[model samples]
Target: MRMKKTTTAAIGAAALLSGLLTLAGAPAAHAADGCNNDNGRTVRTAFGGKGQGFELRVNGSGNSTCAWGRIVGGAPGMHVWVDRSSDGGRTWEPQLGWAEISSGGSIWTEAWRDSNGRLMRACGDSGYNTAITCTTWY
Candidate 1:
């Protein structure tokens, strides 16, 4: 009778520990959720070289906007940037610089505010090549 009780208790403890470990290893929930396009707008543009391309996401809310860039394929040494224009693309802010996507595939994001009635642009360059392509988000 004592052996039976000890075996049952061990099983119960193992089950409880398994449940706790699963919960502890779970991923945390996001705080801001996702970009709310209901009160705002979103645009996606494609750029890059032949087999290697990139997509840009422009999420705009009120006078604020966030831009994100992601590599579509295995593009090595690819770099991109986001530029802001307050005067309907007549002029643009300084190039926000370039970022190379990580090997594990992570997206690059930038945010700016007080850009009401302005425009956002995503540009990309393939390594040392001087040629570039840009897309505007209104």
Candidate 2:
């Protein structure tokens, strides 16, 4: 009947408007801040003198990890590295070093396999020896 047709048209119009509104309000997908990768797992800690810190992230693919370091309060001559582990946190591989002189901050990334589940350890140095700050496992 006429009422049934009008009701169907109203429902269709409402559905179309809802879909349009959802699309209009949607935001574009963006990679994680700093690391430029989709980090599904994250670990953060402080290192060196006060205000210095390190963060490690594992990509969603579980085949890569990224490390970021920052020296707050105007610290200079920063150094960083990421150590990968496959046996939980019991053992860490050799230090995968990162460049220094990043007065503001620095980021580093490396590929890895997730067969045994992966782990990443971040280390930072203001000027002296490097030390572990945080560890992330995925």
Candidate 3:
């Protein structure tokens, strides 16, 4: 199966949630709490690829590094975009220009770098809104 580029209707929320999933691993097929909602973007990188990335940590209510993430229960049409590059952040492919939040009243997200300089991001829903936010990448 291929990962299609999808856009959520919620807007800013989508970006936040996408960040959560990327940083926290939302368990698309199974349940994995290993990536639960956490505090402000914490970064940790173990010897994996080239050995230089990190694990993002996020929290709800006030810890946000990106836009549209300072408040909870954002207005309708809230969302975000993502960009990535295998060349070490020099050039990035517009992963998801923008997406919306489907569910969850509150959310938190985190981001970090990997050993190979590959970017890793994650985010999670807190209120459990349930709109099914998605991501799109090239």
Q: Which has the greatest lDDT? A: 1
Q: What's the TM-score of every candidate structure?
A: 0.56, 0.49, 0.28
Pairs of residues at least 3 apart in sequence or in different chains that clash in candidate 2 = none
In terms of TM-score, how similar is model 1 to the real structure? 0.56
**Tens-digit per-residue lDDT, 16-86, candidate 3:** 88998897864322212342333544332121122212123333322222211122444333443334446
Per-residue alpha-carbon lDDT of model 1 for 24-43, expressed as tens digits? 97634221234432332336
Candidate 1, residue 69: lDDT: 47
Between prediction 1 and prediction 3, the one with superior lDDT is 1
For model 2, residues 44-126, the per-residue Cα lDDT tens digits are 55555655655554554433334333333425566655666668768866455453655455544443333347566666666
Q: How far does residue 16 in candidate 2 sit from its true spot (Å)?
A: 72
Clashing pairs in 1: none
lDDT, candidate 2, equals 0.53
Compute the lDDT of residue 126 as modeled in candidate 1. Answer: 65
Between candidates 1 and 3, the one scoring higher on TM-score is 1
- How many pairs of residues collide in model 1? 0
Candidate 3 deviation (Cα RMSD): 18.1
- The residue-level lDDT of candidate 2 at 133 comes to 51
